[model samples]
Target: MPQVPIVAAHWVYLLGVALIVLTMIWRANVVVPSVLATFLVALAWTHSPIAALGSIFNASFTAAKELFNIFLVIALMTALLNALKVLRSDIRMVEPFRTVMKDGHTAYFVLAGITYVISLFFWPTPAVPLVSAVLLPAAIAAGLPPLGGALAIAIAGQGMALSSDYVIGVAPGISAKAAGVAVSAAAVADRALVLSLITGSVALLLGYFAIRKFITKPDDGLLERWQAKSSNGELARIAQEGTFDKVELARGTAGDQTPLANQGQIDKALAAIPDAREKWSKIFAVVTPLAFLGVIVVMVLSKLGIGHDLKGGDAAALVGGVAAVLMIWASFVTDPLREFLDTSADHVTEGFIFAFKAMGSVLPIAGFFFLGAEQGLSAPILGVPAAQAPNLLFELVQAAQHWIPGNQVFVAFGVLIAGMITGIDGSGFAGLPLTGSLSGALAPTVGLDPATLAAVGQMGAVWTGGGTLVAWSSLIAVAGFARVPVFQIVQTVMVPVLAGLVTSTICAVLIWH
Candidate 1:
């Protein structure tokens, strides 16, 4: 890598990273500092306050554009859930799972096993919301804490399956190309798979032990207690679909947000509900699971024997599309055909509102980090040509590279640390090239195999940036599902996840390297 000019923007970006980390340490929301950092970085880079001001919106817009799929999945999944709620099918859908998930311990492993398998083929981005929507309720009812469920999903799906990317081979392909080694991409992917499982196992084991304390014994109130925390836009408020806190049926309105006009409309709408609610609920409970199971089956088949052609987004798009269709169908079932349009629109609108409420804060924070990434993700935020954009994060990594010793284990762990740093940008794969290049260069000098070193770096980069440890990453999806703050998810998984990464690197040096 060529020497990147150390500019004021670099310093500002570093300061911003520090401020956000400190705010997190203080248990405060990091959004303010993140927005401030983006502004400062822009001012330093452009030397114009006007340009800096525009950069805030630009940064957030860029991040939102990149992460819109996540927003869509959340919205559609919620819409589906809302529709099911009208039919009372949502409860029925998860009822059977309560049988399978007899306890919190059983639910945790069940969540992990299912998440790992789905994420291995479908990618965790979509699978997290899908699984969270279907299985998470059941898991909670079975006595698993919402936070614990989120932990299981993040570690098994994002940290484990994503780190390896075995089914797709995308991550290994990037590393292999940057590695510039004689080794094939498949070879690197194979090694990465082994290392990933080791890391995931360690992380999951430690994570399970840590979260066990939060698990409560099964009881009817366990699920209700969790629901009580839900806001007006959440599943708990489905009964209040249009309105009625105190305004009641007298006005058929509750502030300006009410969708219906009067008691007549309310009664009419209620009357429109199919008399077969119980029967339809039973049918949908069976059909909903079958639909999702089929999606999983088809996704696995589509990707299994293919030559590394799958994209993480494909599964998300597929699931979102299916959820949308199901939601519309359920709407028609719940209301008269004339009211179907209104009801469906209401669900869609609420879905978007909830999605933004849950994930809107993530944009600016993610945008701040994106300004330090490579051109494709950062160029717009910087208002610079793609080729001219500075990869400030990777450049920082390279600036400190010389301090690493020429010892094998140190170099391996050094690459691991570097990978973790570059991963701070939140796109885990974005750091792969830098880590892979470092591995290729440092491994030969330190008596380490580039493939092994590259795999170690892959594990670190993906596990951290992919979701388990970062608030701005796809971990927000897990947070949204669990209805907890993203920082809580980060804090919960940090110790175990880091321990697992460290142990995996040590094993790589001792065994693979």
Candidate 2:
């Protein structure tokens, strides 16, 4: 086979990625560097300065269009959570779990279990609010440290559930597509599931032990201290400005004193709920979980080949649709008939604002990486035919392939590190195509299964960028909800997540090579 030429633009892309990774390690914002690098790479590849400027806009637009579903699901789920809050059904959802949580030791695992389950079905984007709003306070009240609560949610929801993405199938689907494999998404999903479990269990256990010394006896004082701490953080400013309400809900003091106008509105909203309708709060609480549970059961049955399988985006849509309907039902039950539509609209608007606040920064960063993936979004902007569009990252990796050692161990770790580097942008799934493409290319050279390599790469990308090791990722949501500093949570989970990644990679080589 003929060798592909290595161009100066390829080197520039590599340098750009290295700088982004270094910036992240230094605990600095990488968005500015990412945007600059995208412009430079586009300028070099297209040789047209004006076209390069256009590429920047096109890249971010493509990223937002591709990821808009994630934003929508987050908004729908958040809206559902807001409606639940009006009904106080959010608290009811976790009341039973609180009994089993009992103390710090049990609370840690309980939080992880519930978070993992819900995130697996609905994606962590949606599940985080529900878990944080309801179970987080319960876990805190049961003696889990605020940081501990954050770690459990990050490792379980973002790391474990998202890496497998078995129910929604998004992660594996992306990986399989990039690998150019004829295999089913389930082939990737199965391996990812086992690897994620190993990684998550190891990380969660190590995290628990690290924070064990900080655990205190069950006390209201712990919750109060956390609330105070949260009030001083970046998210607090949003809440103080009255733009965010979920923070107060997480602190379990939404009814606390506020501006009279705000208080009056809250009082009026509560008063509108007649005594008979109050029963619907508890009823919906029970029905909501059952509805979601049924969704999961049907998904599982489909996966087992007993029914039509809901794959990839279809599964996410199902969950989002269900949540939207539930939001409407809960809103109607909590307000007068004439006011329910307005109430629901307000909840949805708040949800969209929150979702954008949490994830808007990701768009530009994702755009830069998406360009490297030959996603076709930049072809028109660069004035190139789609077939001739450059895949900057893939070409660079292919050029360097001969220099990579033939050792399976070396290749596995190389892919793992590459995945981790790509993850520095802090959108875990955005880097999947790059890693998956590399995994497929390198696996044959190293005598390893492509699926196993893909799973190992997924582990690194999702675990690190997925929010456990990175402060600026979705981990911020975990930090915001748990009332802890984002970097502190990152510090607590770093060693454990690294250890888990190393161990799981080694296991993948042994089990599947």
Candidate 3:
């Protein structure tokens, strides 16, 4: 690739960063700025009005293509979660864990631990409801505040665990792509693991004490007090009422349909009916976990020189394939052959619906960032380069690297902080490639492992933007789901998040150095 002149495109890149920062400071969505910046940058670079128009479409579409895999994983996992809910296995899966949630402290750690593991495997969007639905009530019952439950999950799943992205590989894929490194490279994965653990551990400990101070003894009167103060009581009541209505309808239908049937026949059918859900659910719960575990085992074995070599998309394929098989098996066990087709279709449709609804806005937002990478978009920003394709952000980072010393600690912390600041835009992922590239460039100067610094940067960017500390980030979704104030979530998360970042940064300096 030929080097493109930085010139006007450099200023355009700075302007985009400014626009993003300004939007973030105002707690507004960065989507508009991203789109407008991509267009203007492309327009200025190409100087051809026609090309500018085309770049806008190209940037967004290219980004969508690049990120579609991530979108699919989220969708499939969500679909799987919803399916589990329908089978009621979602509830049963966590029932045993309730026994461990005997106190606020216990509940706090348990929720965090469970969320970290599950989200590590499936991603947070899908894992949220499962943790909330089953474990939340248990945590509340064990004297953990609803806010505490929320805090634990955000720290573990959204912040620490997701920052690394070991199993799903979404974060790594994006970071590596931006850094011009190979996916699954040792440097990126290893460093990401270390940094993520440091941050997550710190965040978890800080959150524990904050909750401890607020925990009330498990008194009967406390439930009433909490209900009185509960911002979400009405929502819960409405949901409960809706559930009751469904139960009532099922009972009425059973009564009406059973009339004139033999008592023995009716008894046998009713006995078998509950068994259908129970039997199939048991099979699915047992089979799904085992199947997923088997895939992981196979993947590990393959990495170690067994079976078949799996590369890009294979990891996702393994997960999706297993999920599909489980979906089919569950459908079959629940109904006869005739019903299986209908059930499968219904579930897949539901999965897609859930997937799109939750993530529709993200694609366009991602497209805007994706625009930064392409020459088609750059032509619109910086007049025609004879033969060079401009990388706006990467060029900016490289130009500025000389001003900053390659102090390993400083670079790691600086990148981490820059990532956290970018996350203020509430789109944690928008600037990863820039950070990742910068990390790689700076790493050689600092005598540091580029991957480790990149991973540290990844941690800061993701944890903040991914919803742990930022009120305006996806924390809104968590607040909405938990029926708590979004601002309160931010307040509760601040100490823990800061603690996590500091610990992770210190760990990087000490251990990696």
lDDT of 2: 0.73
lDDT of 2 at 65: 81
- Overlapping backbone residue pairs in candidate 2 total 0
Error of 1 at 126 (Å): 15
- Model 3 lDDT tens row, 1-513: 344457875687578767766676555666677777767776676677787677667666665666677667655665566566566655455546767877878888999888887777766765666676556666776788878888888888888778887766667656654454333434565578778887888778877877779886654454444445534543333223221121122112222221111224323533544755877766666666677778778877877889988776777767776777677766777678998788788887876665555444445455554445445433333345625666666566566766877677888888888778767655566657556656655666677766677777788888887877766555654555455776787887898788878788778777777
Of candidates 3 and 2, the better by TM-score: 3
The CA lDDT of each predicted structure is: 0.71, 0.73, 0.65
Task: List, residue by residue over 246-326, the lDDT tens digit for candidate 1.
Answer: 112111211221112223433454455567676676777678768877776666666576433435466667777888898
Residue 220 lDDT, candidate 2, scale 0-100 = 66
For model 3, state the Cα shift of residue 23 in Å. 1.9
Task: Report the C-alpha displacement of residue 358, candidate 2, in angstroms.
Answer: 2.7
Winner on lDDT between 1 and 3 is 1
Best by TM-score: 3
Instruction: Estimate, for each residue in 94-204, the C-alpha lDDT of model 2 and write its tens digit.
Output: 546756877988999998998998787656765676677666776787688888998999999989998888755666766665564343456788899999999998999
Rank list by lDDT: 2, 1, 3
TM-score of each: 0.60, 0.77, 0.81
